[model samples]
Target: MGNTQIGHTDFMSKVRLTDRYVASVSPPPGGRIEIFDDNPLGAGLILRVSQTGRKSWVVRYRNEDGEQRRFSLGLYPDVSLAEARKRCIQARLAASDGVDPAGAKRRRISERRSRIIKTFNDLSLVYFAASECGEWKPRGKRKRPSTISGEKWLWTKHIKPSLGALPLEDVTPLDIKNLLRGLVDKGQDTSANRVRAQIRQMFNYAILEAEVATANPVARVPMMGEETPRDRVLRDEEIRLVWRALGDPGSLTSAQGARRANQRVYVSRPVALAIKLLLLTLQRRHEVAGMLRTELDLDQAIWAIPGSRTKNGRTTFVPLSPGAVVLIREAIRLADAGRDHPSAFVFPARWDRDKALTPASLTRALRDVSKALFLPSLTPHDLRRTAASHMASERLGISPLVIGRILNHTSEKGGAAAVTLSTYALHDFMPEKRSALIRWDKLLSEIVSTRL
Candidate 1:
């Protein structure tokens, strides 16, 4: 036992190290201090007195690395000596077992982080960050901000509020099912599917990085039969009616009626132009949204989308119609004033000004176009399907490879152009492609010209 020197009378709450804490008494400057008895392994708390008469406790013990470790308990005069001593005892017991007191403290901190209630908002930050990490790099190692921007939109608009704060371990398949069902109820099958995918990705991250061991609950959730695309290609007469309906508010009664009413709602030209662009380009919404100024070559009449920015991860050449080019120029001319002023993206989304447009916004606009034009409930994706249908038509036929390249579809067997060199250079069949697009566009225009 050390000499029984009296501790300072004042209360203290200072800890100089883990396992060691000084009592409320702020020790006066200097030397030897009263320490707990028989602390041979340095288990008892000890306070170091400073020149200014302040004291702090430190608990000395061996660390995992076999070196001496000191743990801070609290400052003297703030943390009472008794409490500091008690903490030192606990820390000593921890250290005696070769358990680092600091490590235990870290575990407690991690546990607290885990215990934090993850509401539909809490997991969003981590979820979005993980989402951003999946984007394409500019040259190779660095990621593109546009990709980051897209993920951020989905995470913010569709994901976070939906299932952000749920405990990673607690989320279940049923929760995902319910979320899908909610999207179904909202007439957003496309968004529902997207949310489902994003959730699965988030869970995977939680499992891998956050030390959360949980099955991907969202993976098991099933979607309704049809994924609603705001760009459903209009049939010949359907296109005509849709086109005619664009100007006629009365003919849209059927589209705007009860059961399928949630498709979309719009009463503006920007919305109308958005619908037109989907058919004109036969593109996914995000593609058009992220269109850049440098991508369009008016002289060559091509709208080139870089492989990095595209969903398909390949460069795409869109043979622009004179009408299409005009529309694009108008779109560029009418760029959103607030944020999308400097960079590109044809139909920029307002919420995330940095990216072109959101999938939801495109879907919504397309749905409104269909409903307003009095066409069969169409989706943006249906534009591609419609293009496929026209290409598959018996009257005018286009080769599958050309179609595949244009739409960026991976081969069904996944071994087409890769092993077969001839298939890769098939875009030389341009006369056929041009004729087909012209026919398809005219057919669509005809479809829009129809009536009941």
Candidate 2:
């Protein structure tokens, strides 16, 4: 080869390229210089050193049309001397095969840029947005906001830290297994299972809707732990303890007396009222947490939860007991007092009144106070179960069917009975539900009133 000059300077030199030689070369003062690699392995490779001291690898070749073209291999030190040579040989072979290597390189880059979801995080955003818009639900159905919120929480807390930055196609079953195993090892077996389910659903969404992933990595992965149906029912004594810990009116009076003697109230008033309402009404945590002022008619003692907010996509009318009514009134007062404007939700979030209190926040509050109270470790759902169990006991003598109605549970029965209940039984059972909850309130009053 011959030296090529540009801009009144010799800008080309021929040499056998080595890592040591490339590192020792200094940048030109004015114009860029190209160091041609004379080694047979890197016949058309050139090390382009600009006047700004930046170094990069370039491959010069002639296509089938006898057209000279240059393609950038990558920056030096990052794409090292040996890697540059390997890429140069590949580029030359492509050129000799009557292919325009520069065009091919540009096509590959353009294809990559055209992909909307490059990483797991990108895929998750698309999945969540689609879910919120009801695109993922069955015909005429919608996804629950709480379900979306819980999935997002799982992604942000558990999955995102491990796989969010990974390319969509790069997440393997082994990576998913390791993540679940880590959670299982920490004794979070249920959480591990939940994480696994969320990840599997996300990848399925990607495959069906986004067309990003070809296969679900979580498909072959087994469940990390056994999840039994939870049948936890807090005993009457435990219920009393929890009710007191929640700072009910009786508990608050005592807390205030303690505060006069320098004691602190750990439970917030709004959350306490919400939890009490959960036990009194036997409603789902999310449904109660997202209770809107418009959904209630205090005069008629009815709380009409819309189909949009429910799990089974059926509207439910819950009869609020006298106690539940009082609690709702107090929560509304607190909600109005906490913000500059009136909140639409009965249980408004503490930080942002425009939104309702999150179901996760309700769970967290119960978890923390339960631990502090040294009571049996229980969840908010356990409180609902406790109420249903006691109402079914010989003391209250409420039937399972009535309790199920109060809980707004969809009928799992099949055949004619299912059709009868689902299609014909259009009655809201307001009267029956009201009587059951009133009996429950009477029994609960006696239970919480007893001296522990």
Candidate 3:
């Protein structure tokens, strides 16, 4: 009988690996073949052939714990014999240094996944939630929806597109500066400044609250450019023109009064009246636009602006003049007309009627009125300044302190004085403000009565 092998096991003598010898080897039936490499760098390297004739390179070593373990480097031909030898030496060296090679590889993979998950886009969302809940401010007052809306737009338009994908720690000031410079080069210096402020605020929140960033990337960057203060107070004639443009039918621009009214985005009558309230109250455009009918006390001639509505996040009670009262009543009439009950917003949006007027709509209306009357472009904020200037003049004899209260100018006086006024002197100065507003109303009446 022929000499026969009882099993498929074949053990080969150690030899230096070669491409030709590796290609000629085959596994015995129903068993694997083991071939050891003689090279010193591959002292533990073995060519493993399965019962199905599959080939792979593996390394066996005693770990620091004195436990035997096997690590697969790669398949033969795919790994190449020379590359397998290099990896086997590295693995042995790691085992000698008390490192678990398999555990180390897993740790590296985990760190890469962590970097992907901790990107700026992720951090910004966390920052936004904190800001929306009022955690970002010293007073802990919730931000207005419009203010938060602007921040979201800024992130979406500018921040998210440039650096959102990068990990938070990876963002550098140079990245921020380059973005700001691009905006400045396009004649958007003011916009760049605003974006810088918003981004800096977000980064600061990340550092202090989220603890995701070690430093604020934008903290060192200066504001893009000096913003020129606008001192464009309206003159008497311009005031008359504005009033007429809002009130008089003939004063409507050709585009506003024409047929196909739906196509034209002219200011509705209620919005015009809202502008009248702006001039009368000297309130910010957003404050007036977001007014609720419930906040007004027509009988008491007072409009109470809640703390959240004001820029300083303090509740303000504005005394309404007799003239202002009349305008408000007319606004109510317009709002309540053709409705079941009084609308929630004093200045309901023209499109929705249930919601308050948008800051954008108020701005657009003022723009149209300015264009229609051929007056210098003016804003609702200019009206606020004009009211303060007139009230503080010697002609009116209204004290600066009273004017400050009426305007809610807490930051007008800095340092100890501002702190004292805000903290200890919580008095509303209601009667003084009322007298000052009455005086202002008389002067405004005389100014608007003139037909220019």
Give the CA lDDT, 0 to 100, for residue 37 in model 3: 88
Best by lDDT: 2
Question: For residues 192-292, what per-residue lDDT tens digits would candidate 3 score against the true structure?
Answer: 89889888887777665555566888877888755788898887788777877777634455344456332433677777877888888888888888888
Model 2 poorest 10 in a row by lDDT: 249-258
Supply the global lDDT for candidate 1: 0.61
Off by over 4 Å in 2: 1-114, 138-140, 248-265, 338-340, 450-452
lDDT against the true structure, per candidate, is: 0.61, 0.84, 0.79
Clashes of 3: 0
Q: Rank by lDDT, descending?
A: 2, 3, 1
The better-scoring model by lDDT among 1 and 3 is 3
How well does each candidate superpose onto the true structure, as a TM-score? 0.58, 0.70, 0.63
CA lDDT of 159 in candidate 2? 98
- Compare candidates 1 and 2 on TM-score and give the better one: 2
TM-score of 1: 0.58
Sort the predicted structures by TM-score, highest score first. 2, 3, 1
What RMSD, rounded to one decimal, does every model reach?
A: 16.6, 20.0, 22.4
lDDT of 2: 0.84
